[model samples]
Target chain A: MTKRAGRERAGRFLAEGAQAVREALRYGQVYEVFVTEIAAARNSELVDEARAADVPVSTVTDRAADGLSETVTPQGIVAVCELLDVSLDEALAEPKLVAVLVGVSDPGNAGTVTRVADAAGASAVIFAGDTVDPHNGKCVRASTGSVFHLPLARSRNITAVFDACRKAGLRLVAADGHAKTDLTRVDLSQPTAWVFGSEAHGLDPEVLDAVDDVVNVPIFGKAESLNLATAAAVCLYAGHLR
Target chain B: MTKRAGRERAGRFLAEGAQAVREALRYGQVYEVFVTEIAAARNSELVDEARAADVPVSTVTDRAADGLSETVTPQGIVAVCELLDVSLDEALAEPKLVAVLVGVSDPGNAGTVTRVADAAGASAVIFAGDTVDPHNGKCVRASTGSVFHLPLARSRNITAVFDACRKAGLRLVAADGHAKTDLTRVDLSQPTAWVFGSEAHGLDPEVLDAVDDVVNVPIFGKAESLNLATAAAVCLYAGHLR
Candidate 1:
């Protein structure tokens, strides 16, 4: 099946590996689960969760499982569940505290930012451009199921999103590791849309151009940068709690 | 060969693949680098750095590379250089501010904590028990090379580390995430030692048993937990910068 086709087949995205599957069982809004014969037989935890949840569980060939997987290493288990579908319009109407992730490719980093957003009381998390899918198992797991709880979705038109946010009385705040604006000094109580970029390339230039304020977390060490997720967490925490 | 022996022979710790290697180059303090015949011929950025720095470089077989590697996928590059040894005796001599990592397994998490400690200007970082090796390429990279710049090392006896810290005037602050004390409000100005635990389990009873205060980064949303590295960063940034 095509990648999008596979995504469409299961309302929930595919998540693999024992730990990720375990997390799905515990926290993911899992509708149903599928496992290959080898994996199901070998990983009793998967079998137990499938049995305990009384969710429909089935077996496929390892090759079949491989074909369905988007990851390099598929843990032979997949779950189909409902989409998170947090609405931008709803979030804006309420508080206009939104988080936009731009071009972040790493699932772990993206998931982490979602977790940070959720922890910080972000009303929504908007993904723009080539950012990885939140439903990717790694992203889902990295989120620790925060994706299941937050207002999150993928949006292609970033400038338009910013425009709408501004129209809703939200200011765009971009987080740069090197920006001179101190996070502690930023006024975060107002309606705001905090934007973070890809771990490597950071925010796209176009997106950067649209931001109302470019801010930074001060760094006083020899290390050139913070991990993307860690940086996002600091900003989000500062934004909400400050 | 045994893991320790393999590292000893190469004068290098195991780094898994291209990503890990990229991280090491970006993050590790020790710059001396080497490449397997295959990796050098691939003419990637790492090989370029090795050549540019005029650091001693060499090539070995993929098999040899794997043997020397510390991860599942070695990707044919490794480095041999000094792992920094940090001394707390001096930092303790003044106002003793230390951060301790307990039972953290992910090298990335461990490294990022080290980097944050440096950024927060904590006098030292003390790893208690089987935390991931600070010098491991992944951890080093994750730290963004923070391990090299700070006073840091592992302690077999966590109690002693805490005792030493407490005696030197550091207040033991443990982050429980659910704790009632707001981290920002807590008096972190004292010589402080912040204790963090593994992502999966959080602070250990023994470690938490030793803390002077337990604090939380108040969450306004539904995230179940923060990424290990990100949580540490928030606490350090909020409480440690002097």
Candidate 2:
């Protein structure tokens, strides 16, 4: 399940650590949970909850738990869960605030944005155009189980995603550094989908052209620009607060 | 320079990669630059800038470059720079907006908050209590050169730091999850110092009691809490927008 190919083939991924395992049991398609003796002792309530849910909980050796974890210091618990991504239509249905990631290769950044989008009450997170898989181990860990709290989708065709967002009555606003409009000046009270690109190279020219508005998060200090996740938090929360 | 002792002993640390090296040259007290032949060729303008600054740019073997870098894929440009931290008095001098990190052990989280604070035009970033060193290699890399763009301070005594902020005529506001006040309701127009704690265990009880105000970033979704950097970004930018 560590490899994307393996996960796709099995239609499952491993959610490691206690928090992830618990959230998987609560809000995700958790197939089975493997826990070390110590982890079972520490998370007895979680194990009981899993058992109550009719999800099988197996106590494995520490070595087996280590094999299933990606972190150096394994939390001694892991869960096999069905991939959680929904279809684009399902994710964006009646969307008011959405976050779209285009060509974001960093798993940590992608996951952090997903978590931020969830915290801000965004309707969905769409991974578009070469973005990292949300189910990747590190991405899942970084999300701290928010991956189970919201709808997520992946689309190779970013243009079609933009069209669908428009069809859902969302104004596509690209968060670009070079844009003339300031983020604060934008009227975020309307249903809006905030489009963000990779931190290295921002939105492609064509993608920027497809957006309804391009706004820059104001940078008042000497820092060149905000990272993808930070910018996403501000943009989504701006819409939420409005 | 990877170890805290080594950096403190030499009174210097390394700025790795092209962006960090460039920013170090532009805004920091750069002692020297080590570059691989390929990196020099790729960053010719940066090399020229170093030369124009009368800084020695030494070309070294890939093996030597690898030895100097913390990253697996070395960008092959590293700059030795003087430590950038200042005294709390200096950092908080006439402050309008400031960020304080208390007991944040994760270098990546600390660095991300530093970058966010910089982008939000915070007056300074003060690492207090048991926080990770701002000079840590991963922290510097995660900061993406913003460490060079702002004033930073470190103090083992978090209480003194808070007192200093109050002494400097700024309100000390702690970003806690269980706070009574919502972040949107805070009067951010006043000069404020936003205090943030580690994601795992939040602000200490006495620390929370000491703050003038405690506010929570509204979580409209099912997420248990926002990560430290995400909360800091929203808090700092709220002050910036005000």
Clashes of 1: 5
Question: lDDT by residue for model 1 over A68-178, one digit each (tens)?
Answer: 676788878777666655556655676556788888889888888888888888878887767777777678777866776666767677766777678788888999876
Off by over 4 Å in 1: A8-77, B5-67, B71-78, B91-97, B178-180, B240-242
DockQ, 0 to 1 scale, candidate 2: 0.64
DockQ of each: 0.48, 0.64
Off by over 4 Å in 2: A36-38, A60-76, B60-75
- Per-residue accuracy of model 1 over B84-131 as CA lDDT, tens digit each: 544555546665557788888887778878887777666778877778
When superposed on Cα atoms, how far off is each prediction in RMSD? 4.6, 2.5
The candidate maximizing DockQ is: 2
Residue-by-residue lDDT tens digits, candidate 2, A1-242: 88899999999999998889988998999999999999999999999999999999999999988888888999999999999999999998869789999999999888888899888988899999999999998889889898999999999999889999999999999999999999888877678999999989989999999998999989998988888888888888875454
State in Å the error of residue B86, model 2: 2.3
Cα-based lDDT at residue B67, candidate 2: 94
Please tell me which predicted candidate would have the highest TM-score against the true structure.
Answer: 2
